[model samples]
Target: MNAPDDTLEFTGGLVARLPEPADFGIALAEGFARRIGDLSRRAGAPAAAARWAARAAFAA
Candidate 1:
């Protein structure tokens, strides 16, 4: 479903005003979390991988 115009405008403006350093920190953390998930999957640890992926999605 499409967001209402005012809601879209407010969210778009909010995102546009976020600090660059915060974005960089989030990207770095997300990349590290995803890498952990990948390694866990490669090591045949599905439970660990799933947990890491969930953490990444929740935290990031």
Candidate 2:
């Protein structure tokens, strides 16, 4: 395993536009939830239906 380094290195010059952090986090969470639901449906287990139901509740 690689040891954790605490040094701050500015190697890459990447411009970030983070005006709305909340919106970004919400979008990220929504994407992750959708992916989980899709994977559950594909797996076709007993919990798959619950996953879809959760998606519907959160989406609406």
Candidate 3:
């Protein structure tokens, strides 16, 4: 997924194709977890999904 030019790229390879925290226009951690949770659920990425689930349990 191509991110906006203003956002930092995920070169670390922890979770790929995640939207930048700023994209959600909310708290950094919460936004990161929310986007990852949704993406992982759709992409069937179990590791990322698990992290998202644990970090953002309220969102799920």
Candidate 4:
């Protein structure tokens, strides 16, 4: 993926494409929302999906 202007360029051609510092929460929330939605469909439980997503997000 192409890195945005504000993102940091790392070694080994890996790019970290993060939103602005002010928008970090919004970005993280959006990702969590999407992941929860996907996991809910597969797991059939919103609470479990959210728990799994929370763990994964925290680990990341």
- Global CA lDDT of candidate 3, please? 0.47
User: How high is each candidate's TM-score?
Assistant: 0.50, 0.44, 0.33, 0.38
lDDT of 2 by residue, 1-60 (tens): 111142112211111222454445444544455565666667774675846644664354
User: Tens-digit lDDT track for model 1 on 12-48?
Assistant: 4332345765555444554455566667677788875
Candidate 3's TM-score: 0.33
The candidate scoring highest on TM-score is 1
Q: Which ten residues in a row have the lowest lDDT in candidate 4?
A: 6-15
Give the runs in model 3 whose Cα sits over 4 Å from its true position: 1-26, 45-60
* Shift in Å, residue 42, candidate 1: 0.3
Candidate 3: tens digits of C-alpha lDDT, residues 1-60: 333343322223222345665334333434465566667677776875556463664244
Error of 3 at 10 (Å): 24
Candidates 2 and 4, the one with greater TM-score: 2
The segments of candidate 4 whose C-alpha lies over 4 angstroms from its true place after superposition are: 1-19, 44-60
Model 4, 1-60: lDDT tens digits are 343353211112223434456355544554554565567657776766656664455345
Which portions of model 1 show Cα errors greater than 4 Å? 1-17, 47-49, 53-60
Each candidate's root-mean-square deviation in Å? 9.5, 12.1, 10.7, 11.0
Better of 2 and 3 by TM-score: 2
The residue-level lDDT of candidate 3 at 48 comes to: 54
